[model samples]
Target: MNLHLHGDAIPEGLSRRARSFVASHGVRADATPLEPYRERWLALGVPGEVIDRAVAYQERWGGLVLPPAPVYECGPRYLYADVPEPSHGGGWWFVGGEPRASVAFSFMIGPNGEFGLWGDTWAPLHASVEGWVESLALTHHASQWAKQVTRLHGDEVEGLSLDDFEPVEEVQGIVDTWWRGSDSLVALHNGEAECFSGRVRRVALVYSGLDKWGLHGQ
Candidate 1:
């Protein structure tokens, strides 16, 4: 897996949009380290590996919102993780977003570091916090590199063919998905849709006619 350079918490694999997001919208002050929450998390029996990931995530992208849309033309689209709360039904813990789902005002993270909702849906959007950041960055930059961008909604999203495309390991999809091909890329935004409304359950982006650099998402 690709990582950020020395001293920079943001991953180098992430897109310029993701960087700008932290720059423009992130809180000016650095949030307190997750080390303080270590004991509490351990008390919940959260795996040591998962706790390490969360602490690392806090240092890297904790306060910054994880936008659902690739091209973010709006604010407060997704909620970033915050302090953990035991006030949850399942084994999941409240990490970010709210119960209402308007934004990251309240959301939950699974024992394995999956970013998700815990209410009626109880679904994870990304396999892990790292996956969410990588996927968001991919969507923002990949769209600009493509020759064409296609948006799919409703049943149409499931109709598309991804013959040669493979799952982008950077994003381990749970409710959402990302696929890559020789000349194209696909991003599904069911995470946001499911949290907002469980009705349609279809939101995909197809970036085709990509150049060599676009294919790799430089």
Candidate 2:
């Protein structure tokens, strides 16, 4: 997986608010060393290759911006005790994103180098840190676009299916990112829809509601 280090570059097609958020808090080109965080991952027994890739990602991008939320952070035991285990066997280590918000999105890295998004429930997002970064950048943009649509067409959007809006095609090829169905649309549920490229089918309905935004894996 090729890493797309978005050092201070606001992804194209984000709203003014989203663009401003990215410009203000996007990853820094001159990021601090992540060596200090290695011990934390090592303590959790994260695989060496996963540690290396994750650390290298942070070093290059400084941190990720999933806006409306703060940059992703890494540390020991960042996962809340409440977070359930993934169905697979690997030990889960917290990657980043706000974990305490009413609608939170937290990332977890598995021992086998798998990455998952914990929002309402755990869903495998990417296979590696590089893939995760690319998917996340696209997710952030999609999220901002959703917010813009909500503000502009709130009432009209109620009960409206995602098919009404054009399918977002820019995020293709970011591994583990696109929804499985070819005709998937961002269906409005409770006033929001998690319209991104690679969202899984099971969690698609749950993600449509904005209320589920920060309810990480609950």
Encode model 1's per-residue lDDT on 109-155: one tens digit a residue: 67667876554455687776656666766766686688899888778
Candidate 2 lDDT for residue 198: 28
**Whole-model lDDT, candidate 1?**
0.62
Each model's number of backbone clashes?
8, 11
Task: Give a tens-digit lDDT track for model 2, residues 80-148.
Answer: 111223334445444533344443445555445455555454444445444444434444544543322
Clashing pairs in 1: 79-104, 96-107, 97-104, 97-105, 97-106, 97-107, 98-105, 98-106
Query: Model 2: how far is 212 from its true place, Å?
Result: 31
Q: Candidate 1: TM-score? A: 0.67
Sliding window of 10 residues with minimal summed lDDT for model 2: 74-83
* RMSD of candidate 1 to true structure, Å: 5.8
Quick one: how many clashes does candidate 2 have? 11
